[model samples]
Target: MKRITVSLLLFLFLVTCSQSDIRHNQDLEDTTYSIVEDKNESVIRLSSLTTFDWEKAFLFSPYSPQEMIEEQLDVDFKDPSDLDMRDDIYLLVFLNKGKVVQYAEIERQDADFSIEGNLTPSNDGINIERY
Candidate 1:
């Protein structure tokens, strides 16, 4: 009877461990796929822009220095009347014809920025088809 009980306990432990491992792996795969999907979408949208440049595309906080932003885009930060200085992160993009686009709700960690699961065409960027 003791032998049978020990074997049963061991089997249960092994089963539980395997199940946990499966769940962990599944979570990792999902996260990886989500990152990849975001990256691919960003590439597609950026490629559609007629005057997109890698050097000019960057992340900035609302509190970032005005000089930094103005220098990067080579445009004056005129503080447009329609612009609201919301406390949030943004992606500054420069386009042809002296157009500038700002994508909001960007995620920032120290100096790193991530758009994963945050991009929406209507809110974050223009429709690729129209651009």
Candidate 2:
């Protein structure tokens, strides 16, 4: 009975290890952007803007701007217009065919900040940089 229990535990361990390995491999294969950390900030670069979801990347990120603002300033922004009025912000640089098209500077003080831009392909490609 002890031998059987040991064998069952070993089987479960192998299964868990294999599942973790599969997930790690899938994440490496599915990653579309690269993140670089520099001192106090991180830079996210995307080869194509079409695949970039700003709302998901920023507003819903692990360290969301909204949560940061609320924690630091004790203020909340409910409207899009309110974000534009703030001073403490981060920048999103947009490119079309590797050329700069538009940019947005999002204030960290705002609870809900949205990025607006023309993501359509004007030349042959699209790229984005978020810092």
lDDT of 2 by residue, 30-117 (tens): 3322212222223223334334322212222223344453343232322222343445534333333332333334334223233333
**Which numbered prediction scores highest in lDDT against the true structure?**
1
Report residue 130 deviation for candidate 1 (angstroms). 32
Using Cα atoms with residue i matched to residue i, what is each candidate's TM-score against the true structure? 0.32, 0.21
Candidate 1: deviation at residue 20, Å? 52
lDDT of each: 0.39, 0.33
Clashes per candidate, residues 3 or more apart or on different chains: 0, 0
Weakest 10 consecutive residues of candidate 2 by summed lDDT: 21-30
